[model samples]
Target chain A: MHLDKEALDAHESRWRAQLINAVAGFKPVNLIGTIDDQGRTNLAIITSVVHLGANPPLLGMVIRPSPKGVERHTLNNILDTGAFSVNAVTEDMVPQAHQTSARYSGETSEFEATGLTPRWIDGRREPFVAESPLQIGLSLLEHLPLKHNGTHFIIGNIDCIDIPDNAVADDGTVDLGALRLVTACGLDTYHSVGSGTRFAYAKPDQPPRPI
Target chain B: MHLDKEALDAHESRWRAQLINAVAGFKPVNLIGTIDDQGRTNLAIITSVVHLGANPPLLGMVIRPSPKGVERHTLNNILDTGAFSVNAVTEDMVPQAHQTSARYSGETSEFEATGLTPRWIDGRREPFVAESPLQIGLSLLEHLPLKHNGTHFIIGNIDCIDIPDNAVADDGTVDLGALRLVTACGLDTYHSVGSGTRFAYAKPDQPPRPI
Candidate 1:
């Protein structure tokens, strides 16, 4: 099926949005954990996290515009504390991670409500999901505003990482298949990654070789 | 194993970069197609594409700072023409897609060199990979500078999309497993997605219902 801008605009706004979101295909799912000044923990499912660079070790995620002036608790906490955690949402964490999207009262903590435990570092203000196979601690490096669209691209410097010993292969790549990490499509669908296929580094005239 | 900032800095630079890149896990891989003003087609493998907003149907991709004093062909082309195409790389296209990352001269066409066909839309200068399960045409929306890290986040408005009929579900989500699409880990490993698990819309007090 082919969908042009005009055809896409013809559909209901919600339908178009979902359709557009899904067509981009599978996305890495992460549970973004943060804490407000009052010590309230916030957890939200985020699929926009992507690697930005490696030298200084940076990562970026997109924060959508809040609806009708509603408060985005996660974004607000990340901005206020300048610290956040990116936790890989595995198959087991799917239900809890999805529930984090629901709006709860200011005093209510998503960690407590969803039955996910918050693991805190000694001196850091933010928390990480205890159930995650891979967890990362980051400090806010820069946040760029997309003026054309009312979205913010938040970039952070990686300060720490936690992973299972067996998950790290000889080459340093995480064996996500063994961890059974979940990838998201559209809004609620999740998929598990299977065994990886390693290919030889592509050279000018060489065919691909299996590693 | 846990890696703090000091530990990460202690490793060899190349090893550290590879380890940091892979621990984040699977990433969506795309063949970014662009054309120079001289009508030479260029294709490069990019894993940083993330959904920004669906209302305007925007996508953002990170363009790493060029090496030393080199120019990024894909970034330069997109800036010069204000148009580009994003094509999902499938299992069969991995070799060609990966080769696009190699440094080809300005006079070389990665499309022809890699043996991938470039399918151009009517009146559109940018071309999409003919073998991609999903192809999207986009126009430049905005490019934001990341001065802290020396990177550029290129945001674009999706103008059109092409996908296989069976790949899209009735609810508007794409079935990536059916397409046998590939995801990247680190710089060389690729993985195929397994069956998807769907959940109902999350609510404050309701348990997750399977869709």
Candidate 2:
């Protein structure tokens, strides 16, 4: 099947969103934890997280423009407090993680509503999902507005990272398969890690060998 | 173990890169195809692709600053031609896709070197990977540079999209499981999709029901 620009533009907005979102395939799923100035807690499930750079220890995620007149609490809290946490969603926590996307008022705490525990670490203002096997605390470093769309790319510097001892390899690679981190597709689908193959570093004259 | 900013800053750079890249877990992998003004074809495997928005059908990816003084052909080609194509990397193409990351002279064609075919589509300036099950041609919409890290966020508007017939669902969701698309973790590890679960749209006061 072919979907040209004209046909994609002519399709219903809802269908286009679903198609485009799903077409990207599996993405890292994380629950973003933020706190407002008044100490209000906000948690939202986001699948757009991407590693930006390691020297500065930066990570970036896109926050879409709020629909109609609704204000996104997650974006607002991140800006207000300048602190947030990214928690890897696990298989057992998939239900609670997805529930964080529900249309709740800003005053309503998604963490409490979804029955996910919020824990404070390093005395940071934001909370981290306690059930998550891996969690990282970040401070807002740069917030750039993406003009092409009304989205904002939130870049943060990793301040503190917590993980299980068995999940980290000697070379510093995190064993995501052993961590049992869950990935997401489309809007509502969740997937668990399966068979994985690691290839040795590629070279011009050398064929890739399985590590 | 807890790795705070102090510890992270003291670690070796190579360890930091591997750990940070792997901590994101699985990410969508694609082969980016482009051609320079001189008509030299270029292809590189990238995992930073993210769906920005659907209304304008925008996609964004991060192009890190060239290591040392070496140039990145993919970024140079996109800027020169104002066009590029993203092709999903299949399971069997993992080795070839991974090899595209090797440091090759800009004069050398990665397609020929990696044993991948470049197919022109819709009279576009760029060529799509012929082996990919899903391919998209895009025109450069916006080019934003990150000041903090010197990375470039290339935003492109979808001009055309091609996918296999059986992979698309009635709701427009792409069944990655059926497509057999492979995802990447860390820098060299590849993983195929596993068991996936779908849930109904979440609601404010209602518990999420599995679909």
Candidate 3:
């Protein structure tokens, strides 16, 4: 199948969304936890997290514009309080994490609606999902508004991280397969990955070989 | 294991890169192809592709700063030509795709060095990986320099796409499992995904159910 820009623009909105989303292949699925100034907590599943840099420990995510007359709690909360939490979505948490996308009122927390436990840390305003094996706390660093689309590209600095002790390798690589972390395609599909192969550093003179 | 910012800053650079890269879970792995004005081709393995929007078909990627005085061909080509291709990395193509990361001199194309064929479309300046099942052509739309880390955040508009006929579902979701696409973690690890479960649209009143 071949699709040009015209063909893509002609596709039904939902269908185009699914196709475009899947074209990027499997994505990192995580539940972003945030809180408003009134102490109202919000949880939303995000799959657009991209690693920006390692030295500064930066990550970027895109947040769409809020629906007409409806406030996007995650974006607003992050702007209100410069902190948020990222919790890796595991296989067991798929249903609850998917359910968090439902349109819950501002008064109702997704944690309360989906029955997921919110883990709070001392001196931190954001909440993390207790069921997640890997949790990260970040503070907003830069928020750039994309004019082409109304989406906001948000960059954050990693403040701290909590991971399972057994999941870390001697070289500092985290064993994602051991944690059963789930990846997503499109807006609704969830995939569990197999134990992967690690390759040695590539050199110009030789073919890549498994480490 | 819990790591605060201070602890993370104290770790070795390579170890920190591995740990920080893995925290986000499985990432979409793609071979980014570009060509310079003089027609020298460059291919690089990229794992930072993120879906920005569906309607305009926008995607964003991060390019790290070049080492010392070495010219990063991929970044320079995209900026010079305003065109690039994203080819989905599959299980069979992992070794060759990984080999593209080897530092080759400007005269040698990665396609030639790794024994991978480059497919060029008429009138398109970028080349797609022939071994890839899903290939996309994009034109540069915006280039924003991230001041925090000196990385470049590049946004592009999808111009065209080529996909396998049998891989697309009725609802427009592409079956990545059928394509045997692979996701990467920690810079060197590659994982094949299982057939994912698609969930029905969530409603606040009920638990999410598989579609």
* TM-score of chain B taken alone, every candidate: 0.96, 0.97, 0.97
Per-model TM-score versus the true fold: 0.97, 0.98, 0.98
Q: Rank the candidates by lDDT, best first.
A: 3, 2, 1
* Pairs clashing within candidate 3: none
lDDT of 2 at A59: 93
What residue pairs are clashing in model 1? none
TM-score of 2: 0.98
Q: In candidate 1, what are the lDDT values of residues A1-211, reduced to their tens digit?
A: 8889898788788777777787666788898999989988888888889888788998889888566644478778888999999999888888888888776777888898999999988878889999997999999988777787788888899999998989877656667778888787787888888788777766766766778
- Better model by lDDT, 1 or 3? 3
User: What is the interface root-mean-square deviation of candidate 2?
Assistant: 1.1
Best by DockQ: 3
Put down candidate 1 lDDT per residue, B16-120, tens digits, no spaces: 777788766678899899999899999989988888888889988988846763448889999999999999988888878888876677788898889999997
Q: Rank the candidates by TM-score, best first.
A: 3, 2, 1
What is the descending DockQ order?
3, 2, 1
Candidate with top lDDT is 3
DockQ of 2: 0.79
The docking category that best describes candidate 3 is high
